[model samples]
Target: MCRFLEELGVAHHSAGAWHWTSDTYPADAISLRAVTSDNFVVVDITNEEKVIAEVAFPAALLELHEKAIYLHEARQYQVEKMDYPQRKAFVRQVECDYFTDAIDYTQVKILEEFETCPLGAARAAHGEVRVNRQIVGFKKVKFYTNENVGAGALSLPEQEMHTTSFWLHFPDPFLARFSDLTPTEKLNSISGMGNALRTVAALLLMCDPRDFGVSLTEEIRPGLEGFEPNLHLYDSYPGGIGLSAPLYELRPRLLAGALDLIRGCPCEEGCPSCVGPAGETGARAKDGATRILAALVEAGLESGAAPQK
Candidate 1:
């Protein structure tokens, strides 16, 4: 990913030059002069702001920084000026990871096997028919990271891995939104569903403003706190858009409209149906929903304007 970024004209510096001895370094290092490079991009992927304070790079530098982008994308770092309060510096960082192996597909098959198949119409009157089928489909999984001060002491070799899982069900109100969804939206729903999806995506893909770092939160919930390799039995609902498990004609349309509304929303964190009330997922779902919707629209316009397949 770093190489890909370099090819994209991103600016970066090696971590080899970073070595800190004391607290005095962060403040003292700010005064050091920086050499003007070819593209004038400076990338910092470490939590070395104290040292950054001492280094002086030309303002012309693009500052193509790289850290765990997810951590600092939102907040600003405070760099104290000699006689001033502080300076706000905005930086962008892109993070990358290696793929070990594909997720086990058997898990998806298992999910299908356990799906609660809908029963057809029980009995009909003179000319009437009755049918109420349950929906079965996959929802999202959440993930979190911990950067707490003393938490690292609990690890061996100092490592943090994906933790906790929430397979609990969402109430009908949430599912009702996706009753009629398009195939495109259903697949996108995995990572681009409601306001929560957008917020989580931003949380996952967005870099921190300080040093562009990505890490999971310490919070835990089934659908809101674990990483998903593949959709599983625990990840599915009773009625909705599920291709292999079961097919419901109306499910896709229902889901599509609700998702469109939420995704099309225009809010920062989220609004009503999209992200849900702030009490539900931390922020209003509207803001996040709008972001996700914009992405879907853009993708659709690019993919030959193909309808959900």
Candidate 2:
């Protein structure tokens, strides 16, 4: 690789290593993760301007937005102002009963399908996708009770990336079984299942939860109305680090693991450890997701291929 770069006039061989020949450093031109090098500094300006903390670019929109509650050392601080141009947020110490949950909207477009398999009326696939994400709003939930006390709007920039993903596509025939469920209910069910799948995938891959992201949506294709809903588990890196392909090959095991995790949970409805938080995922989310997974398992069994542990 070093010789190739040197021959291409991109680098020079020096001290048994390759160094960039250009004025710019190679590391300065590339990002290691999805996060950018830019950051937002948190300043305490109640009495005098003092740097309190710094938040990364990806998290600043959600954590340092105006009116946001920033937590530091178990102490709560309310954001008084956000200076995006300066990449600074002014905060003041405050007491609050609840933290905030940012609501993000994500859309994934399939660029290429590398592999796929039929599971009853649904298809499991792995592919390249372009993800567009935007943090639009946030909700404040009271402590202990978890009741949403308030909501706030945000106008931040959208984040876009091309990544690899493993997804399950439920066709119309499979969705017909849940015709009785409202659209909202169906969405919640998909959300619950996506959450469970993310958790199981992280454990199976031995990777951090932040290494991948999950989303459920019916808009994988543009200008295609009434498309099937897809549950996507995508690598969080810009171009991916070879995670989705393996996940595609392990679809059966992944489904089985997710099913087992949800079933083993003792929650009556749903909790973050199982499906998702009951407040956001809905009371019937666990049951709905269970039914969907059970149907897939039954389909696998009928085909003489049950998902293995």
Candidate 3:
């Protein structure tokens, strides 16, 4: 695999080595190893769509899959299989199963055969879903494998949470877009989502409120006194709502519930389904939310709660 990657012009470094020696070698082992090490791009040669689904490859490398563009790929899946209502539904179910099962198998090394399906399924399901030079948010993704939702797991453990323990700072351009909303309104919406998520995380994980403070604002200010958690909210970069579970933590039902909610969302560009409000966020912020949402849904958190919008 290393040879193949190098031949394909992929770099060979500390992160370049593949862990093919494992029992699950070729499929999950390869992709898991690459993703875990935070490799920005992977030159995958497997003819399996299932593996592709598992890794959430960056949009930059999708040309290797064929010639489909990201936007077109998103739409092609709608009718890739006869456009039959039931088949479409089945495709989603199977996709959710494939992705979650991949996550489960990779993290725990428990179930093997079931998670080894080819990515051809994903390709067949979405004929033109190309992941090209669009800067796919592959790097911002993170994962945990557990059997319990709370016994030993977090409701939503986002990548940003793992990478940084900081607050959000709206870019001047993005902040300017909301000029009509008064600083307070902008602050409310921004911090409101964070507060809601922290509150929910504390409630779900049974962790002490002090550990994950309730505040969302940079500092306490006048008029926003009611949002007490605002004072306690720590700013996190690449932040957004998402779920984290150990290899043993996930159950089939919990995974299914998460997918159902994701497939049901109305937004085509992020939003609650794929991420948060895309048009309303900065360029960097837009990708993180959508990628996190997609990762959670793929990981089996379709119903992962988002703060009330």
Candidate 4:
């Protein structure tokens, strides 16, 4: 490790220990957490050009976008301008009764597949993927009632990321069982299943929910058709942080746990603890997700694909 650091011109080996080579403090140059290292600065332009807070890169698209409501220390600020080139957001204090939730469109393409297994009619795999995401708009929801009072459109540049992911591809034979479901319903089902997987993965990994991200897509790659839709759980960091491989290994346990979580939930439709909030995930999301997970579990059991430690 010291040799690698020395090669990077950051450290030197002397007296059986590694020492900083530069006059500047090494700690000052290094960020403790890789995910939060590249961040955007928020400036308050109401009174003066005062630095208010900092937002991480992944979150800046949703939290610091133009017209977005940013909450800090229990106070609310409205983002008036977002200068992506400058890596800064100009916001002003505002008294509003609602908050904002950004709506984004994401596409994931497999860059390289590391490991794969056939679980019944579905294929589970872990690999590197390139994610293309664009924040299209946001909804203004009232504070207490959680009512979406309004929404606005946004035109911003797309953000691309390379990360490691654990994904499930439902083959056409498996999806045939859902022939009665419309395309929207299928999409909703995938969304719900993805949410459940994210929750269960976090629990199994003993990590925070924010450490992983979920995405459901009909097209795993561009122009691909007749293939199964994909539900992905990716490490939410640049270059990843050793999460996807473990998740791939625990695929069976993850699916079974997700099934248990959804089946045991008390909500009739769906809640945050299960699939997702009913308002966003559709009315039949929980039911569809339950059925999908049950099928996955059943297939794994029939094939005797036990989780490998």
Identify the candidate with maximal TM-score.
4
Clashes of 1: 62
For model 2, name the residue pairs that clash: none
User: In candidate 1, what are the lDDT values of residues 1-309, reduced to their tens digit?
Assistant: 655544545434367542333334344534333322212222232355322222232222111121112223443332111211122233333332211111111111112122221111110001111112111111121223222212101111111111111111222233234445443333334322433332332333342221111111122235753322221111111222122222122223323454565646565544444544444344423443344344434433444332221
RMSD of each: 23.2, 4.0, 22.6, 2.5
Question: Candidate 3 — what's its lDDT?
Answer: 0.28
Q: Write the per-residue lDDT of candidate 3 for residues 1-309, one digit (tens) a residue.
A: 676764655434356454333343345445432233322222222233221232232222322122211122342221112111121111111111111111100001111111111111110000001111121211111125222221111111112222112222233343454345555555545533443344444445454433432223232345643222211222111221122221112322322343344345575533533224444333333233333223433533333322111
- What does the lDDT come to for candidate 1? 0.28
lDDT at position 208, candidate 3: 42
> Could you arrange the candidates by TM-score from highest to lowest?
4, 2, 1, 3
TM-score, model 1 to reference: 0.22
Which segments of model 3 are wrong by more than 4 Å? Answer: 1-166, 203-206, 214-232, 235-309
Model 1 misplaced stretches (Cα beyond 4 Å): 1-192, 195-260, 263-272, 305-309
List the candidates' TM-scores in order: 0.22, 0.85, 0.20, 0.91
Clashing pairs in 4: none
lDDT at 88 for candidate 4?
Answer: 99
How many collisions between residues are there in candidate 3? Answer: 35
C-alpha lDDT values of all predictions = 0.28, 0.84, 0.28, 0.87
